[model samples]
Target: TIAAEGGGGWKEYAGGYSDWANYQASVHQAASDKAKVDVRPAARPVAAAAKAKGDKLSWKEQRELEALPERIAALETEQGQLTTLLEDPAIYQRDAKAAQQAAERLAAIDDELMELLERWETLESRAANQG
Candidate 1:
């Protein structure tokens, strides 16, 4: 259906179409920008839990808990060393076996470190809850 009334109807339709397209584009852009943002709340440090009835950790338990950071740091240092070794171009090119071994060792260390961290957190949480 062609409306030929000085092309006013066609101009109005074109103008409306342009406005609608622009509005849709702006909405999509806004949504994309919002999606790019990290909307999750910032994590807070774990608060010390309230003391339980007649619950006290031993001195040894306290000492081990205190030493967690040091142990984690040591493991991190070892991990860094392994990472450096693995990254060496010479090792990758000249000694594939050694590189593979290093990668395996690194993975094992990572697993062990993750386990240790989990255990440490569990113990710490328990201690906090007991205190």
Candidate 2:
């Protein structure tokens, strides 16, 4: 209720309102974390039974592992180029040399990320249990 100034009652006013919002958040804190949740889209591959998984590498895995040398060589080559560019005398000509340095760092991070990806692929292929 509001009284008008003309009435000389109180001259009260009300005109502020926040957004009316209803939100539901479901936070499922994993209990124990011992149970692995496979939420990814792909169905997990079943690894060989514990007994049958002798140290022998599968044909595909052997191929992938053999390819590691080439992949590592490429990653190392890219990293070396990135380092050389960062150290090159002409690269410091930019107005934001600091930013250039940061860019170089980002490049290094990208190279490392690639290396990690390669390693992960290799390891995934070599999984005793491909699950």
Candidate 3:
């Protein structure tokens, strides 16, 4: 069994990562079929927030903060796509290079996501601190 945090909650899959990926794809497909509107939270205005915090962030840092959400979202989308591709057993035989590249990209995405999330949290705290 694989335990994971997903869809704003935690769930345990009965099998391994492939099973979890299949389940997630099915869920996403069903949601898309329903044409459900995605209501994402608004991104904070980094410039204004940084200004309010009185130079807590430099201009470059403010720009980085502003771009974080979109960059994170793009990486997540790519990760999901790579996971789906890797789940197909035929992919290994059909094109080994493609499969290998996908796997490498997925690993890179994982590392990128971790770094971005940590930096985002640190910047958010600095931007929110009154002192």
Per-candidate Cα lDDT values, in order, are: 0.62, 0.46, 0.71
Local error of candidate 2 at residue 78 (angstroms):
1.0
Predicted model with the maximum TM-score: 3
Q: How high is the lDDT of residue 3 in model 1?
A: 23
Model 3 per-residue lDDT tens digits across residues 10-93 = 654444677567656754564564345533233346435655767467778879889999999999999999888876767756
Candidate 3 — what's its lDDT?
0.71
Candidate 2 stretches with Cα past 4 Å from truth are 1-54, 95-131
Displacement of the residue 40 alpha carbon in candidate 1, Å: 34
Which pairs, if any, clash in model 1?
51-131
User: Of the candidates numbered 1 and 2, which has the greater TM-score value?
Assistant: 1
Error of 2 at 96 (Å): 5.5
Give the alpha carbon lDDT tens digit for every residue of 1-131 in model 2: 23343556553222212110100011122211212453433323323332256545668656766777677667667666755654443444453355354444545456455655755564555564554
lDDT of 2 at 3: 37
Model 3 lDDT at residue 77: 96
Would you list the rank order by lDDT, best first?
3, 1, 2
lDDT of 1 by residue, 1-131 (tens): 12244645431212244544553465456556545773434222222332332336668668978898899999899999987875465675687678666766776677679767876877677788776
